[model samples]
Target: MQNRQNQIEPEWTIIKILQWTTSYFKTNGIDSPRSTAEILLAHTLGFKRIDLYLRHDQPLNVGERNLFKSLIRRRISKEPVAYIVGSKEFWSLELVVSKDVLIPRPETECLVEEALLVLDKDKVSAPKRILELGTGSGAIILAMATQNPDQQYFASDISINALAVALNNARHLGLDEKIDLFCGSWVSPLKENNNLFDIIISNPPYIRRGDIKTLQPEINRFEPINALDGGEDGLACIKHIIKNAHKFLNKSGTLLLEIGYDQKKAVDEIIKETGRYAQASFRKDYSGFDRVVCAKKAYD
Candidate 1:
């Protein structure tokens, strides 16, 4: 243990450091200690996680050890692994993330999956138009565009910094030219565009205000509060989107949303209250929790 020191013992190899870090993380009550250790170590060494095993016997020089030590300290402080490593994988595509945006979770991929399914089933021959609200890191829109490149895609976010991250991701994924990016709340900026989209989707903030503080420290402490707080009952953003989406969707257009697991019933009611959709349905994530809401506008 090199506390307040710049150098690790010269004999510390990749395997040795991983073992030590995993134990240290576990003792500190970090979740997925071994996986965290491997990710951080791989990030510090600029190698893929698989490469760590291939180079298990390689010794770390002083600089590499120092960097890994700093990352370990940050982890011990409960900073998220995604922020520390600066990326997360969603829909099998690696996306850039920061504290300015919510880290794309696996559950949200369910929204993308359902939206793609809807698009696939659509009998329309012409290219369809799509819009995504709160497009943090542009994960959903980018994934959708990648799968169906012919569609016109647009995304909006309230935070300019978040939009910047999304733009960076879009550029890296080579979908920048394909997706139009906007910086504004939900449908505000889209109102003047005069574009009625075939599909409207979002993964808005759905955590109740009171519950924000109760989340994991990695989320409550490190991720943006604005991206997590969903007002009094965790339905503020969801309600707003549900109410406004039909205005921008074409006749029979589909609206897809990634919502909190327990929000299905409430969101369903919100959809009904609007009297804007002809049909609405819910989909479960891999964990069998209600995660996405699919609502279709009335043709008449």
Candidate 2:
């Protein structure tokens, strides 16, 4: 029991804490043990991961040690590091996150990549206008604006809390001036405006209600249900977006959406039935899953 007591002690150094946290996470079935340990420790120390290595042997003081222990305990309970650190890196930007918004997933980057491709193909002029629906952390829209500085962007979410988080991220990334934001259900906030976008992108909620229970505890338990629960079959929001998107999209605008692996056929069918889109196609993510669907509105 003495060994157990030592493991829980707060006096551990930077290196020792790293070793302990990694082993603890691994024993608890966390797949990315070492990386998780490094991120959590770096966050607690207010230093970058590389700085942590440079100060490997340095001891953490009482305050720092206590904070590290608190974060370690939360991790052991299966809390996501993004929640613990209150930020996540997406598209090379560290964006703030919380229970109010879904943690940005790496796969969602494909949405941005797909958007850039569509924009390039169309050869949109400078200051092209873009709209993003369900902009949880504002990661997708903000990343695009950051890359295409001349692009004007707008982001909207159904959750007011989510819009707040997205707004904060916009401010932190210095993209606030370039991006307009709104709150309310999809299309509601923009209905009165006649502004047509060159591209519309989204990472809407896609998990089926029944499947939520099967997700990892860090997600199903801690993440907001409204951000993950996609009505009965997970296609509710996607269907709504597809039906109304044409009204907001310019004649030649593109719609880029992130979908679940099994959702490709259903979403594809929806796009086909709409009859307002052309060249609708799916792009696989890094994991080889059919993840992003791109469709362009007919020029007519």
Candidate 3:
């Protein structure tokens, strides 16, 4: 039996490898083992995930086995598959990503949806200036700008590397001309210019500093800490953005933000306490967690 098993191991096929790797992933505490198995295997083989099933009986070449093995080990080590593949899909668009930026998550799309909802009220097609701070990889602004190309867009990040990745993605999507990129913290980019925007959107870091170490290993260890930590209360960035957003908004301009589920009440209170906003509201994500905050500046 031992000799037969040893002799047959060299003939592993796509389906065989997938079954073996799926079990391996489960044993290592990885979630969605089968789905992850397919994604990593397909990525290593340069095949679409569905295509992997099509050629299930095809034997892996020596190179393919070596590469797939490396990816499997990385997954076992808790690296996010999106980083391993080097791109992620947001708003139905594929954007390049690296360790320099946070992988755009599906929940952030709610922020985009809310922004578009507000923009729909605009009767004319005139360009409306919009700005996204902490624009990691330019996901939010790029996705919004792509959908509303006529709008003047600007994106900024404090991290040079993050800004570089965002710029690369902007150029990749042919959005460079439409989005004015900058490197600054929060609203400082146009502070001197006295710039005002019709819409301001952000998904700034909202994770509590101490709680970061308690998050999943893939997130706490792999993603950028600066993009995750929001200080002792987890409202540091949110508070700053809220406090300053009104100063940069046009009359009755809108400000939309993606926030942590637990932060809805706290953020809503902050918005109300400010006394600059007309009224603030919250939107829930698919899981029924309060995921976004929508507010408008008072028309003076």
Candidate 4:
């Protein structure tokens, strides 16, 4: 390996480097080994991910190779790739993220999916009022607003740092003006807000307190605890939103939330307990897990 490094025309090319990194990552127990290698290499080279294939035979200089080695070291230590790169792609829109916010996951996209379904079905007028609770990184609301530009949207978070990342992303996508952002927990900022929304959506923290310790290192270590802890049974945040959502929804307005797969029965009971929602149902993600719960307000 040392001799190959010093060759004037090094034998280590893009394809060769990727092969080595892929095997190395696999040995270290990283999932999607090949893809992880490609993503990190592309970031290190400042090239588009697909560009990697186009330049398969390209050789890196000593400095570039060293940078990739550094990135690999970070990954080996279990640092999340998104945080390493400082952004992640969600709903096909790349959003900035950091330790302050949960990295957007594919399952959360289902929240956006169900929201669009409700919007299209209602065919409500443009500027349909929508609010998202616990809007970490603004993933759900921004994706919804981007696709439905006519909607009036608002999102709130208690952590200023997370909100800052979300704000930057909104500005980057030129959708900043579309969302009214607030710095407060749950419904605090919406006080005195009578029947204000046509739809309320959130992917709030629902991971059980005990279960969090069993999560992947990527989650348990890198992600923020406040954003993951659901208190005792992981329903603390969910229950609060369900109870207050009725007060903020117009007649027949909707409250959509994402919850743990197994929490369906528990959350269902919470919705029923309020008796404020007319219809409560769940939507499965691409993986066929009960990932999102939808509740329609009962007329006052």
Q: Which lDDT tens digits does candidate 4 get at residues 109-205?
A: 9989999999999865656899998888999999998899988999999999989989999999999999988889998778645538999999888
**Lowest-sum lDDT 10-residue window in model 1:** 1-10
Answer with 1 or 3, whichever has the higher lDDT: 3
Give me the overall lDDT of model 4.
0.91
Off by over 4 Å in 2: 1-11, 124-126
* Span of ten consecutive residues with least summed lDDT in model 2: 4-13
Residue 141 in candidate 4, Cα distance off native in Å: 0.7
For candidate 2, lDDT tens digit of each residue in 17-66? Answer: 89988999899898699999999889888899999889888877768878
What does candidate 1 score on TM? 0.95
TM-score of every model versus the real structure: 0.95, 0.93, 0.95, 0.95
Tens-place lDDT per residue, model 3, 1-300, is 989966786678999999999999999899999999999999888999989889988888778999999999899999999999899999988999999999999999999999998898886677899999999999999988889898999888999999999999999999899999889999876773389999999999999999999999999999999999999999999999999889999888999999999998899899999888988989999889999999999876
* lDDT by residue (tens digit), candidate 1, 1-300: 556343555569999999999999999999999999999999999999999999889999889989999999999999999999999998889999999999988888889999999999987789999999999899999999999999999999999999999999999999999999988988887653387999999999999999988889989999999988899999999999999989899888999998998999899889989999976899999999999989999765
Ranking by TM-score: 4, 1, 3, 2
Which residue pairs show collisions in model 4?
none
Cα RMSDs, all models: 2.8, 3.2, 2.4, 1.9
Candidate that beats the other on TM-score, 1 or 2, i.e. the better one? 1
Note the residue pairs that clash in candidate 2. Answer: none
**Candidate 2 local lDDT, residue 262:** 93
TM-score of 2: 0.93
